[model samples]
Target: MQFTDEDLGAWVARQRWYAGKSHVPRFRILDVQPAPGATRYLLMDDAGAVPALYNVPLALVDAPSEGDAVVSRTADGYLIDAARHAAFAVGMLAEMGVDVGRVTGSRVLSGEQSNTSIVFEEDGHPTIILKLFRTLHHGENPDVTVQRALSDAGSPYVPRFLGSLDAEWPDSGRESGVARGTLGFAQDFLPGVKDGWAVALDAAGERRDFTDAARDLGTALAGVHAALGASLGTVDAGPEQVASTGLTWRRRLATAAAEVPAVADRLSAIDAVYQAALERPWPQLQRIHGDLHLGQVLAVQDGGWRVVDFEGEPLRPMPERAIPDLPPRD
Candidate 1:
């Protein structure tokens, strides 16, 4: 059943991704496409000054609400706020087509900073993770797009690609005034792995011997870069191109200097580093993790790291994020 605009409005406000909590946002459903029992919505949310689209996937839950809310401590538990829970219980579930007759318990995974993810398990068997995308964008999400590309290319580091759900409308007369289409995704549950950031920070904080781990990471990243380069196409590295690396750093420094008053001195220092990086020359340009930080990787227990979340830096515009010509993350 298609959810009403009232339902969509109430649901989005409570979600962690709804950046505009101060006021009620308006929605415009652009399109709708339905599957066997589920539907995908393309939504336009006007929350204050920011307006964008999101992909939301949901399934119904039955039985009793016997489980405690899943909470994440990484972002200080901000993602699991009350509004988010309400949306999950009502808006999200309302769109799902699953007929879960019995829900034994619900466990929310802690530590995720971006999406409000809930792990639903029944009869002691691990099920799927409901990923509520916090930030919305147009076009295909890189996480989903890249994962499909990698899976098609037979990459092993990524988790198995499970079916996803999105929102869409049949015509202009849909009750949901907002183009409520594909809002979220569902992916296979990857168990027993620590996010790379927590692991790296743990190692850094403890001053433990992490050279081997770092080398392993370096190799894995290199492989991914190589794969991406081959899959797409690699550009030849030139001395001039390498020298321009400092430009990006300079731009970052300028941006930091404008907004952070206390960081003026630090920005100056960073400027010097940029100058140095400029003088050193540029590395070969190839497709790689545009946003490669510790947080982007997951360390599985089976002796390897799994690269997830292909979505680039949120600060960049959507077009720039998809620009195939950009350099890799520093």
Candidate 2:
């Protein structure tokens, strides 16, 4: 059975992870990959300034459940958002080729800004979290590889990487007319943990000394950097890389000036500093959490610190995200 792009356009716009929310999407179904109990739809959305691809997995049921909306009527069942069902988690595990015991339960995490993540349960207890990538690309997702590397290294700074799913599809842009990309990833769920940002905020609000916590966080970050360097290795910042990075500085200055006219007044002063930085010696760059911040760290009670989301800037191209970078969080 097949469905049209129009079947998903309106529904996609309502999704939290949809980028072009302002405009109704023009969806074009690219490929359909049948999983255990779901069908993964690869779509190209042409409603934005540029065409964007997305991965949407769906399932059909006999009747609409609590939050299910009947996308269409079919003789067998009604098409619904498969990610909301437990079977979707089963299919997701099947898709990722992982065996984390029989999935006893499944629930979507709230306040997801990008990908659709579902917490899966085993033996009637929650355990694994699978993130379905909303935006599609044709390459290795660093979020999987970097974390996987650290996890394999027995690093305590990150959760254990369960597995990841990837698929190949037609793409005329590539020389082979085919491309491969990650679909989703599953990781062990860290239960009863708090974000460093919240803890810091509370400490600040209460006027409590946070030196110990801050030191622990710095240690954890250093451990993460060390693990990444050992796993991925580092390279000297060559002339070309430095020049490219300097160009990025100028670009940032331009953006800052444009965004705040007041910043334009001090543009020359900023440029002078940037010029000085360009002429200075540069350190070896390595794989890093390109988008690191306080919010990305977790404070595990009785534990040190744990970092998550190794994938670089979400806005950067996938391949670029995999590149070795400065720890300064570009």
Model 2, residue 134: C-alpha shift (Å):
1.0
* Residue-level lDDT tens digits of model 2 in 192-295: 88898899999999999999999988888889999998999999999998898888778878988999989999999998998898789988899999888888
The residue-by-residue lDDT of candidate 1 on 1-330, one tens digit each, is 334555555665666665566766787665544422334444567666656664443333232233422222222221223212434533343345443454344456666666767665567665656666655554456666666566666677676655445543433344653333234555556778888888888988999878888788777776676667666666655665555545655777788878988777687677776677656645556555567787778888887887877777676675465545344462
Q: What would you estimate as the lDDT of candidate 2? A: 0.83
* After superposition, candidate 2 runs with Cα above 4 Å error: 22-24, 73-75
- Candidate 1 weakest lDDT stretch, 10 residues: 71-80
Error of 2 at 310 (Å): 1.5
Local distance difference test values of all predictions, in order: 0.58, 0.83
Mark the regions of model 1 whose C-alpha exceeds 4 Å error after superposition.
1-7, 21-43, 55-123, 127-136, 162-188, 204-207, 236-251, 266-284, 325-330
